[model samples]
Target chain A: MAEQVTRKPYVREVPRMLWFLRHPRYMRYMAREFSCLFIGAYTLMLVVGLKRLAEGPDAWAGFLAALGSPGAIVFHLFALAFSAYHSITWFRLTPKAMPVQIGDTFVADRVISGAHYAGWALVSLVVLWLAGAF
Target chain B: MATSNKPIVWGPFAAGGTLTAFLTPVLILLTLLAGLGHAPDLLAYDALRAFAAHGIVKLGLVVVIFLSLWSAAHRLRITCYDLGLRADTLVATLVYAVAIAGTVAAAAYLLRLNPV
Candidate 1:
Protein backbone atom coordinates (compact mmCIF):
# COMPACT_ATOMS: atom_id res chain seq x y z
CA MET A 1 0.00 0.00 0.00
CA ALA A 2 1.26 3.53 -0.85
CA GLU A 3 1.86 6.03 1.92
CA GLN A 4 -1.13 8.34 2.52
CA VAL A 5 -0.50 11.98 1.67
CA THR A 6 -2.49 14.94 2.99
CA ARG A 7 -2.90 18.17 1.07
CA LYS A 8 -4.42 21.50 2.04
CA PRO A 9 -5.99 23.70 -0.60
CA TYR A 10 -6.03 27.46 -0.26
CA VAL A 11 -9.49 28.94 -0.49
CA ARG A 12 -10.28 32.63 -0.57
CA GLU A 13 -13.41 33.59 1.29
CA VAL A 14 -15.64 35.86 -0.78
CA PRO A 15 -18.04 38.19 0.94
CA ARG A 16 -21.20 36.74 -0.45
CA MET A 17 -23.47 39.72 0.10
CA LEU A 18 -21.04 42.28 -1.27
CA TRP A 19 -19.31 40.29 -3.99
CA PHE A 20 -21.63 41.65 -6.66
CA LEU A 21 -20.80 45.17 -5.61
CA ARG A 22 -17.23 44.69 -6.84
CA HIS A 23 -18.26 44.60 -10.50
CA PRO A 24 -20.64 46.66 -12.60
CA ARG A 25 -21.57 43.60 -14.67
CA TYR A 26 -22.48 41.73 -11.53
CA MET A 27 -24.60 44.67 -10.39
CA ARG A 28 -26.43 44.69 -13.72
CA TYR A 29 -26.95 40.96 -13.44
CA MET A 30 -28.37 41.39 -9.98
CA ALA A 31 -30.74 44.08 -11.28
CA ARG A 32 -31.98 41.71 -13.99
CA GLU A 33 -32.58 38.99 -11.43
CA PHE A 34 -34.27 41.46 -9.10
CA SER A 35 -36.82 42.38 -11.76
CA CYS A 36 -38.60 39.14 -10.97
CA LEU A 37 -39.73 40.59 -7.67
CA PHE A 38 -41.68 43.33 -9.39
CA ILE A 39 -42.93 40.97 -12.06
CA GLY A 40 -44.15 38.47 -9.49
CA ALA A 41 -45.81 41.11 -7.35
CA TYR A 42 -47.55 42.53 -10.42
CA THR A 43 -48.87 39.08 -11.26
CA LEU A 44 -50.13 38.69 -7.72
CA MET A 45 -51.92 42.01 -8.09
CA LEU A 46 -53.60 40.63 -11.19
CA VAL A 47 -54.66 37.63 -9.18
CA VAL A 48 -56.17 39.98 -6.63
CA GLY A 49 -57.97 41.78 -9.41
CA LEU A 50 -59.35 38.49 -10.63
CA LYS A 51 -60.66 37.80 -7.18
CA ARG A 52 -62.31 41.19 -7.09
CA LEU A 53 -63.90 40.55 -10.46
CA ALA A 54 -65.23 37.28 -9.17
CA GLU A 55 -66.74 39.08 -6.21
CA GLY A 56 -69.06 41.10 -8.55
CA PRO A 57 -69.30 44.61 -10.00
CA ASP A 58 -69.03 46.49 -6.75
CA ALA A 59 -65.89 44.67 -5.76
CA TRP A 60 -64.35 45.06 -9.18
CA ALA A 61 -65.09 48.75 -9.13
CA GLY A 62 -63.59 49.05 -5.70
CA PHE A 63 -60.47 47.32 -6.88
CA LEU A 64 -60.12 49.75 -9.77
CA ALA A 65 -60.75 52.65 -7.46
CA ALA A 66 -58.04 51.43 -5.20
CA LEU A 67 -55.65 51.18 -8.10
CA GLY A 68 -56.30 54.84 -8.88
CA SER A 69 -54.42 55.90 -5.80
CA PRO A 70 -51.15 57.78 -6.17
CA GLY A 71 -49.27 55.02 -4.39
CA ALA A 72 -50.56 52.35 -6.74
CA ILE A 73 -49.69 54.43 -9.78
CA VAL A 74 -46.15 54.88 -8.49
CA PHE A 75 -45.89 51.17 -7.83
CA HIS A 76 -47.02 50.39 -11.35
CA LEU A 77 -44.55 52.87 -12.80
CA PHE A 78 -41.68 51.16 -10.99
CA ALA A 79 -42.90 47.72 -11.96
CA LEU A 80 -43.13 48.72 -15.59
CA ALA A 81 -39.58 50.05 -15.57
CA PHE A 82 -38.21 46.89 -13.97
CA SER A 83 -40.27 44.65 -16.24
CA ALA A 84 -39.04 46.45 -19.34
CA TYR A 85 -35.47 46.01 -18.13
CA HIS A 86 -36.13 42.33 -17.63
CA SER A 87 -37.52 42.04 -21.15
CA ILE A 88 -34.50 43.71 -22.72
CA THR A 89 -32.02 41.54 -20.84
CA TRP A 90 -34.01 38.40 -21.49
CA PHE A 91 -34.10 39.04 -25.23
CA ARG A 92 -30.41 39.82 -25.25
CA LEU A 93 -29.64 36.46 -23.63
CA THR A 94 -31.98 34.26 -25.69
CA PRO A 95 -29.70 33.57 -28.66
CA LYS A 96 -27.19 31.91 -26.33
CA ALA A 97 -29.80 29.58 -24.88
CA MET A 98 -31.32 28.63 -28.25
CA PRO A 99 -29.14 28.35 -31.28
CA VAL A 100 -30.83 27.60 -34.55
CA GLN A 101 -28.86 25.68 -37.17
CA ILE A 102 -29.57 25.15 -40.83
CA GLY A 103 -27.34 23.30 -43.25
CA ASP A 104 -24.33 23.27 -40.86
CA THR A 105 -24.60 27.00 -40.22
CA PHE A 106 -25.91 28.46 -36.98
CA VAL A 107 -28.25 31.42 -37.16
CA ALA A 108 -26.78 34.83 -36.32
CA ASP A 109 -27.33 36.22 -32.85
CA ARG A 110 -28.85 39.47 -34.14
CA VAL A 111 -31.30 37.53 -36.28
CA ILE A 112 -32.41 35.44 -33.33
CA SER A 113 -32.80 38.39 -30.97
CA GLY A 114 -34.30 40.56 -33.70
CA ALA A 115 -36.93 37.93 -34.26
CA HIS A 116 -37.79 38.18 -30.59
CA TYR A 117 -38.14 41.95 -30.90
CA ALA A 118 -40.42 41.50 -33.89
CA GLY A 119 -42.53 38.99 -32.02
CA TRP A 120 -42.70 41.31 -29.04
CA ALA A 121 -43.94 44.15 -31.23
CA LEU A 122 -46.56 41.92 -32.83
CA VAL A 123 -47.77 40.66 -29.46
CA SER A 124 -47.93 44.16 -28.08
CA LEU A 125 -50.01 45.26 -31.07
CA VAL A 126 -52.38 42.37 -30.56
CA VAL A 127 -52.75 43.10 -26.87
CA LEU A 128 -53.32 46.78 -27.56
CA TRP A 129 -55.86 45.95 -30.24
CA LEU A 130 -57.65 43.60 -27.91
CA ALA A 131 -57.69 46.34 -25.30
CA GLY A 132 -59.31 48.62 -27.90
CA ALA A 133 -56.23 50.79 -28.33
CA PHE A 134 -56.94 50.93 -32.07
CA MET B 1 -25.75 10.32 -6.40
CA ALA B 2 -29.41 11.29 -6.62
CA THR B 3 -30.74 12.79 -9.80
CA SER B 4 -31.34 16.50 -9.55
CA ASN B 5 -34.92 17.77 -9.89
CA LYS B 6 -33.70 21.18 -11.13
CA PRO B 7 -35.30 20.78 -14.53
CA ILE B 8 -38.82 20.72 -13.15
CA VAL B 9 -38.44 24.25 -11.84
CA TRP B 10 -36.15 25.33 -14.66
CA GLY B 11 -38.70 24.47 -17.34
CA PRO B 12 -41.32 26.85 -16.02
CA PHE B 13 -38.71 29.47 -15.21
CA ALA B 14 -37.60 29.57 -18.83
CA ALA B 15 -41.08 29.54 -20.31
CA GLY B 16 -42.42 32.11 -17.90
CA GLY B 17 -39.39 34.33 -18.38
CA THR B 18 -39.97 34.32 -22.12
CA LEU B 19 -43.66 35.02 -21.78
CA THR B 20 -43.06 37.82 -19.35
CA ALA B 21 -40.40 39.33 -21.57
CA PHE B 22 -42.89 39.51 -24.41
CA LEU B 23 -46.05 40.47 -22.55
CA THR B 24 -45.49 41.79 -19.03
CA PRO B 25 -44.50 45.33 -19.93
CA VAL B 26 -47.62 45.73 -22.01
CA LEU B 27 -49.81 44.31 -19.27
CA ILE B 28 -48.34 46.67 -16.69
CA LEU B 29 -48.90 49.58 -19.07
CA LEU B 30 -52.54 48.64 -19.37
CA THR B 31 -52.92 48.88 -15.61
CA LEU B 32 -51.15 52.22 -15.62
CA LEU B 33 -53.59 53.41 -18.24
CA ALA B 34 -56.50 52.22 -16.14
CA GLY B 35 -55.13 54.01 -13.12
CA LEU B 36 -54.97 57.20 -15.15
CA GLY B 37 -58.67 56.83 -16.06
CA HIS B 38 -57.82 56.16 -19.66
CA ALA B 39 -58.47 52.46 -19.83
CA PRO B 40 -59.37 51.22 -23.27
CA ASP B 41 -63.02 50.39 -23.77
CA LEU B 42 -62.28 46.69 -24.14
CA LEU B 43 -60.48 46.71 -20.81
CA ALA B 44 -63.31 48.43 -18.99
CA TYR B 45 -64.96 46.52 -16.16
CA ASP B 46 -67.92 45.02 -18.05
CA ALA B 47 -65.93 44.14 -21.15
CA LEU B 48 -63.14 42.64 -19.08
CA ARG B 49 -65.68 40.61 -17.13
CA ALA B 50 -67.20 39.33 -20.35
CA PHE B 51 -63.78 38.47 -21.68
CA ALA B 52 -62.82 36.59 -18.52
CA ALA B 53 -66.06 34.66 -18.66
CA HIS B 54 -64.89 32.90 -21.80
CA GLY B 55 -63.51 29.46 -21.02
CA ILE B 56 -60.49 29.80 -23.26
CA VAL B 57 -59.53 33.20 -21.90
CA LYS B 58 -59.90 31.97 -18.34
CA LEU B 59 -57.63 29.03 -19.08
CA GLY B 60 -55.09 31.28 -20.79
CA LEU B 61 -55.03 33.73 -17.90
CA VAL B 62 -54.54 30.96 -15.37
CA VAL B 63 -51.66 29.56 -17.37
CA VAL B 64 -50.04 32.96 -17.62
CA ILE B 65 -50.33 33.57 -13.91
CA PHE B 66 -49.01 30.11 -13.06
CA LEU B 67 -45.98 30.42 -15.30
CA SER B 68 -45.24 33.98 -14.21
CA LEU B 69 -45.43 33.08 -10.55
CA TRP B 70 -43.25 30.00 -10.94
CA SER B 71 -40.63 31.85 -12.94
CA ALA B 72 -40.41 34.61 -10.38
CA ALA B 73 -40.25 32.15 -7.52
CA HIS B 74 -37.38 30.19 -9.03
CA ARG B 75 -35.42 33.31 -9.89
CA LEU B 76 -36.00 34.70 -6.43
CA ARG B 77 -34.72 31.47 -4.95
CA ILE B 78 -31.51 31.78 -6.91
CA THR B 79 -31.22 35.42 -5.98
CA CYS B 80 -31.52 34.57 -2.30
CA TYR B 81 -28.75 32.03 -2.65
CA ASP B 82 -26.53 34.59 -4.31
CA LEU B 83 -27.24 37.06 -1.56
CA GLY B 84 -25.78 34.66 1.00
CA LEU B 85 -29.07 33.34 2.37
CA ARG B 86 -27.49 29.86 2.12
CA ALA B 87 -30.64 28.13 3.33
CA ASP B 88 -31.59 27.06 -0.16
CA THR B 89 -34.06 24.34 0.69
CA LEU B 90 -36.05 26.60 2.98
CA VAL B 91 -36.01 29.46 0.51
CA ALA B 92 -37.06 27.19 -2.32
CA THR B 93 -39.93 25.81 -0.29
CA LEU B 94 -41.20 29.25 0.70
CA VAL B 95 -41.03 30.78 -2.77
CA TYR B 96 -42.52 27.73 -4.51
CA ALA B 97 -45.31 27.55 -1.96
CA VAL B 98 -46.20 31.18 -2.64
CA ALA B 99 -46.17 30.51 -6.37
CA ILE B 100 -48.49 27.55 -5.98
CA ALA B 101 -50.86 29.49 -3.76
CA GLY B 102 -51.00 32.34 -6.29
CA THR B 103 -51.73 29.92 -9.12
CA VAL B 104 -54.48 28.15 -7.21
CA ALA B 105 -56.05 31.42 -6.16
CA ALA B 106 -56.04 32.74 -9.73
CA ALA B 107 -57.63 29.53 -11.00
CA ALA B 108 -60.31 29.55 -8.35
CA TYR B 109 -61.24 33.15 -9.09
CA LEU B 110 -61.32 32.60 -12.84
CA LEU B 111 -63.51 29.54 -12.45
CA ARG B 112 -66.10 31.48 -10.51
CA LEU B 113 -66.30 34.43 -12.90
CA ASN B 114 -69.55 34.17 -14.86
CA PRO B 115 -70.61 36.10 -17.97
CA VAL B 116 -73.55 38.40 -17.53
Candidate 2:
Protein backbone atom coordinates (compact mmCIF):
# COMPACT_ATOMS: atom_id res chain seq x y z
CA MET A 1 0.00 0.00 0.00
CA ALA A 2 1.26 3.39 -0.95
CA GLU A 3 1.41 5.99 1.80
CA GLN A 4 -0.86 9.02 1.28
CA VAL A 5 1.40 12.03 1.56
CA THR A 6 -0.06 15.09 3.26
CA ARG A 7 2.20 17.56 1.47
CA LYS A 8 0.64 19.86 -1.09
CA PRO A 9 2.99 20.61 -3.96
CA TYR A 10 3.32 24.23 -5.07
CA VAL A 11 1.77 24.83 -8.48
CA ARG A 12 2.14 27.87 -10.68
CA GLU A 13 -0.75 28.10 -13.03
CA VAL A 14 -0.44 29.75 -16.42
CA PRO A 15 -3.31 31.90 -17.58
CA ARG A 16 -5.64 29.85 -19.73
CA MET A 17 -6.21 32.00 -22.82
CA LEU A 18 -3.51 34.62 -22.48
CA TRP A 19 -0.42 32.65 -21.56
CA PHE A 20 1.04 33.10 -25.04
CA LEU A 21 0.97 36.83 -24.49
CA ARG A 22 3.66 36.52 -21.87
CA HIS A 23 6.53 36.28 -24.34
CA PRO A 24 7.25 37.73 -27.76
CA ARG A 25 8.47 34.35 -29.04
CA TYR A 26 5.36 32.69 -27.67
CA MET A 27 3.27 35.36 -29.36
CA ARG A 28 5.01 34.63 -32.67
CA TYR A 29 4.33 30.91 -32.25
CA MET A 30 0.70 31.64 -31.51
CA ALA A 31 0.48 33.83 -34.57
CA ARG A 32 1.91 31.05 -36.69
CA GLU A 33 -0.58 28.56 -35.29
CA PHE A 34 -3.45 31.05 -35.60
CA SER A 35 -2.69 31.43 -39.31
CA CYS A 36 -4.38 28.08 -39.78
CA LEU A 37 -7.74 29.73 -39.18
CA PHE A 38 -7.30 32.07 -42.11
CA ILE A 39 -5.99 29.23 -44.25
CA GLY A 40 -8.98 27.07 -43.35
CA ALA A 41 -11.43 29.88 -44.06
CA TYR A 42 -9.76 30.61 -47.36
CA THR A 43 -10.02 26.94 -48.32
CA LEU A 44 -13.70 27.06 -47.45
CA MET A 45 -14.09 30.05 -49.70
CA LEU A 46 -12.68 27.96 -52.53
CA VAL A 47 -15.21 25.26 -51.76
CA VAL A 48 -17.96 27.86 -51.91
CA GLY A 49 -16.57 29.08 -55.20
CA LEU A 50 -16.71 25.53 -56.48
CA LYS A 51 -20.33 25.24 -55.41
CA ARG A 52 -21.22 28.45 -57.19
CA LEU A 53 -19.40 27.32 -60.30
CA ALA A 54 -21.37 24.09 -60.28
CA GLU A 55 -24.62 26.07 -60.15
CA GLY A 56 -24.01 27.79 -63.55
CA PRO A 57 -22.79 31.04 -65.09
CA ASP A 58 -25.15 33.34 -63.20
CA ALA A 59 -24.20 31.84 -59.84
CA TRP A 60 -20.54 31.89 -60.70
CA ALA A 61 -20.70 35.51 -61.78
CA GLY A 62 -22.55 36.40 -58.62
CA PHE A 63 -19.88 34.68 -56.58
CA LEU A 64 -17.16 36.64 -58.33
CA ALA A 65 -19.12 39.82 -57.88
CA ALA A 66 -19.49 39.08 -54.20
CA LEU A 67 -15.75 38.53 -53.93
CA GLY A 68 -15.17 42.03 -55.25
CA SER A 69 -16.85 43.52 -52.19
CA PRO A 70 -14.64 45.56 -49.87
CA GLY A 71 -15.06 43.10 -47.02
CA ALA A 72 -14.17 40.14 -49.21
CA ILE A 73 -11.15 41.94 -50.59
CA VAL A 74 -9.96 42.69 -47.08
CA PHE A 75 -10.47 39.09 -46.04
CA HIS A 76 -8.53 37.88 -49.07
CA LEU A 77 -5.70 40.24 -48.26
CA PHE A 78 -5.48 38.97 -44.69
CA ALA A 79 -5.63 35.39 -45.85
CA LEU A 80 -2.86 36.08 -48.30
CA ALA A 81 -0.61 37.54 -45.63
CA PHE A 82 -1.29 34.75 -43.17
CA SER A 83 -0.84 31.99 -45.69
CA ALA A 84 2.43 33.54 -46.77
CA TYR A 85 3.56 33.54 -43.16
CA HIS A 86 2.57 29.90 -42.94
CA SER A 87 4.75 29.19 -45.98
CA ILE A 88 7.77 30.96 -44.52
CA THR A 89 7.49 29.20 -41.20
CA TRP A 90 6.85 25.86 -42.83
CA PHE A 91 9.88 26.23 -45.05
CA ARG A 92 12.05 27.29 -42.14
CA LEU A 93 10.97 24.22 -40.20
CA THR A 94 11.33 21.77 -43.07
CA PRO A 95 15.06 21.20 -42.70
CA LYS A 96 14.42 20.18 -39.13
CA ALA A 97 11.54 17.94 -40.12
CA MET A 98 13.39 16.33 -42.99
CA PRO A 99 17.16 15.95 -42.99
CA VAL A 100 18.65 14.34 -46.02
CA GLN A 101 21.74 12.22 -45.58
CA ILE A 102 24.18 11.68 -48.38
CA GLY A 103 27.08 9.30 -47.80
CA ASP A 104 28.58 9.97 -44.35
CA THR A 105 27.38 13.56 -44.04
CA PHE A 106 23.92 15.09 -43.78
CA VAL A 107 22.78 17.80 -46.16
CA ALA A 108 23.09 21.39 -44.99
CA ASP A 109 19.97 23.08 -43.63
CA ARG A 110 20.26 25.88 -46.14
CA VAL A 111 20.43 23.37 -48.98
CA ILE A 112 17.18 21.75 -48.00
CA SER A 113 15.40 25.05 -47.33
CA GLY A 114 16.88 26.58 -50.47
CA ALA A 115 15.48 23.71 -52.50
CA HIS A 116 12.06 24.44 -51.04
CA TYR A 117 12.37 28.09 -51.97
CA ALA A 118 13.40 27.15 -55.48
CA GLY A 119 10.49 24.77 -55.78
CA TRP A 120 8.13 27.43 -54.46
CA ALA A 121 9.32 29.89 -57.05
CA LEU A 122 8.97 27.35 -59.84
CA VAL A 123 5.48 26.42 -58.67
CA SER A 124 4.40 30.05 -58.45
CA LEU A 125 5.62 30.72 -61.95
CA VAL A 126 3.82 27.68 -63.32
CA VAL A 127 0.58 28.59 -61.60
CA LEU A 128 0.78 32.17 -62.75
CA TRP A 129 1.45 31.07 -66.31
CA LEU A 130 -1.44 28.65 -66.18
CA ALA A 131 -3.68 31.38 -64.81
CA GLY A 132 -2.77 33.42 -67.93
CA ALA A 133 -0.54 35.84 -66.10
CA PHE A 134 2.55 36.45 -68.19
CA MET B 1 1.11 0.34 -25.21
CA ALA B 2 -1.62 0.34 -27.78
CA THR B 3 -0.94 1.65 -31.25
CA SER B 4 -2.04 5.20 -32.01
CA ASN B 5 -3.57 6.44 -35.26
CA LYS B 6 -1.51 9.61 -35.05
CA PRO B 7 0.39 9.00 -38.24
CA ILE B 8 -2.76 8.78 -40.32
CA VAL B 9 -3.61 12.36 -39.47
CA TRP B 10 0.01 13.46 -39.39
CA GLY B 11 0.79 12.20 -42.87
CA PRO B 12 -1.76 14.50 -44.46
CA PHE B 13 -0.78 17.32 -42.14
CA ALA B 14 2.83 17.14 -43.26
CA ALA B 15 1.98 16.69 -46.91
CA GLY B 16 -0.62 19.42 -46.88
CA GLY B 17 1.68 21.71 -45.00
CA THR B 18 4.31 21.17 -47.65
CA LEU B 19 1.84 21.62 -50.49
CA THR B 20 0.35 24.72 -49.00
CA ALA B 21 3.80 26.04 -48.30
CA PHE B 22 4.67 25.83 -51.94
CA LEU B 23 1.29 26.72 -53.40
CA THR B 24 -1.14 28.47 -51.07
CA PRO B 25 0.42 31.92 -51.11
CA VAL B 26 0.15 32.08 -54.88
CA LEU B 27 -3.38 30.77 -54.85
CA ILE B 28 -4.39 33.42 -52.33
CA LEU B 29 -2.68 36.05 -54.41
CA LEU B 30 -4.79 35.03 -57.36
CA THR B 31 -7.91 35.29 -55.22
CA LEU B 32 -6.83 38.72 -54.08
CA LEU B 33 -6.34 39.75 -57.67
CA ALA B 34 -9.79 38.46 -58.48
CA GLY B 35 -11.28 40.28 -55.54
CA LEU B 36 -9.58 43.47 -56.66
CA GLY B 37 -11.09 43.00 -60.14
CA HIS B 38 -7.70 42.39 -61.77
CA ALA B 39 -8.07 38.67 -62.33
CA PRO B 40 -6.28 37.35 -65.36
CA ASP B 41 -8.19 36.13 -68.39
CA LEU B 42 -7.92 32.45 -67.55
CA LEU B 43 -9.57 33.02 -64.18
CA ALA B 44 -12.70 34.35 -65.89
CA TYR B 45 -15.93 32.43 -65.40
CA ASP B 46 -15.89 30.58 -68.73
CA ALA B 47 -12.18 29.90 -68.70
CA LEU B 48 -12.12 28.65 -65.15
CA ARG B 49 -15.23 26.61 -65.78
CA ALA B 50 -13.64 24.88 -68.73
CA PHE B 51 -10.48 24.32 -66.72
CA ALA B 52 -12.37 22.77 -63.83
CA ALA B 53 -14.29 20.56 -66.23
CA HIS B 54 -11.08 18.78 -67.16
CA GLY B 55 -10.49 15.49 -65.34
CA ILE B 56 -6.98 16.28 -64.17
CA VAL B 57 -7.88 19.74 -62.96
CA LYS B 58 -10.81 18.33 -61.02
CA LEU B 59 -8.58 15.79 -59.30
CA GLY B 60 -5.98 18.44 -58.51
CA LEU B 61 -8.58 20.75 -57.05
CA VAL B 62 -10.02 18.00 -54.88
CA VAL B 63 -6.60 16.98 -53.56
CA VAL B 64 -5.52 20.55 -52.86
CA ILE B 65 -8.73 21.49 -51.05
CA PHE B 66 -8.99 18.25 -49.08
CA LEU B 67 -5.41 18.28 -47.91
CA SER B 68 -5.39 22.00 -47.12
CA LEU B 69 -8.60 21.76 -45.09
CA TRP B 70 -7.40 18.67 -43.27
CA SER B 71 -4.06 20.23 -42.44
CA ALA B 72 -5.69 23.39 -41.15
CA ALA B 73 -8.11 21.34 -39.06
CA HIS B 74 -5.30 19.38 -37.45
CA ARG B 75 -3.24 22.50 -36.87
CA LEU B 76 -6.20 24.22 -35.24
CA ARG B 77 -6.71 21.17 -33.03
CA ILE B 78 -3.18 21.52 -31.71
CA THR B 79 -3.60 25.28 -31.42
CA CYS B 80 -6.71 24.79 -29.30
CA TYR B 81 -4.80 22.50 -27.00
CA ASP B 82 -2.02 25.06 -26.66
CA LEU B 83 -4.61 27.70 -25.82
CA GLY B 84 -5.58 25.55 -22.79
CA LEU B 85 -8.68 24.00 -24.27
CA ARG B 86 -7.93 20.57 -22.88
CA ALA B 87 -11.01 18.79 -24.18
CA ASP B 88 -9.08 17.31 -27.07
CA THR B 89 -11.62 14.73 -28.09
CA LEU B 90 -14.33 17.32 -28.59
CA VAL B 91 -12.05 19.71 -30.42
CA ALA B 92 -10.65 17.00 -32.67
CA THR B 93 -14.11 15.75 -33.53
CA LEU B 94 -15.40 19.21 -34.38
CA VAL B 95 -12.39 20.19 -36.49
CA TYR B 96 -12.10 16.86 -38.28
CA ALA B 97 -15.81 16.90 -39.05
CA VAL B 98 -15.49 20.29 -40.71
CA ALA B 99 -12.49 19.13 -42.73
CA ILE B 100 -14.28 15.99 -43.87
CA ALA B 101 -17.40 17.95 -44.77
CA GLY B 102 -15.38 20.46 -46.74
CA THR B 103 -13.66 17.65 -48.62
CA VAL B 104 -16.93 15.92 -49.44
CA ALA B 105 -18.50 19.17 -50.58
CA ALA B 106 -15.54 19.95 -52.78
CA ALA B 107 -15.60 16.51 -54.34
CA ALA B 108 -19.37 16.70 -54.91
CA TYR B 109 -19.14 20.09 -56.54
CA LEU B 110 -16.24 19.06 -58.77
CA LEU B 111 -18.09 15.93 -59.78
CA ARG B 112 -20.95 18.10 -60.92
CA LEU B 113 -18.64 20.09 -63.14
CA ASN B 114 -18.48 17.41 -65.80
CA PRO B 115 -16.81 18.09 -69.13
CA VAL B 116 -18.88 20.46 -71.25
Model 1 Cα lDDT, one tens digit per residue, A1-92: 59766787889989979889888999999999999999999999999999998998899889888888999999999999999999989998
lDDT for position B24 in model 2: 89
Local distance difference test, each candidate? 0.92, 0.91
How do the residues B51-112 of candidate 2 rate in per-residue lDDT, one tens digit apiece?
99999988999999989999999999999999889999999999999999999999999999
lDDT of 1 by residue, B3-113 (tens): 989899899999999999999999998888888888777667789999999999999999999999999999999999999999999999999999999999999999898
DockQ per candidate = 0.79, 0.84
Model 1 achieves a DockQ score of 0.79
- Report the C-alpha displacement of residue B65, candidate 1, in angstroms: 0.2
The number of the candidate with the highest DockQ is 2
lDDT of 1 at B61: 96
What's the lDDT for residue A106 in model 1? 98
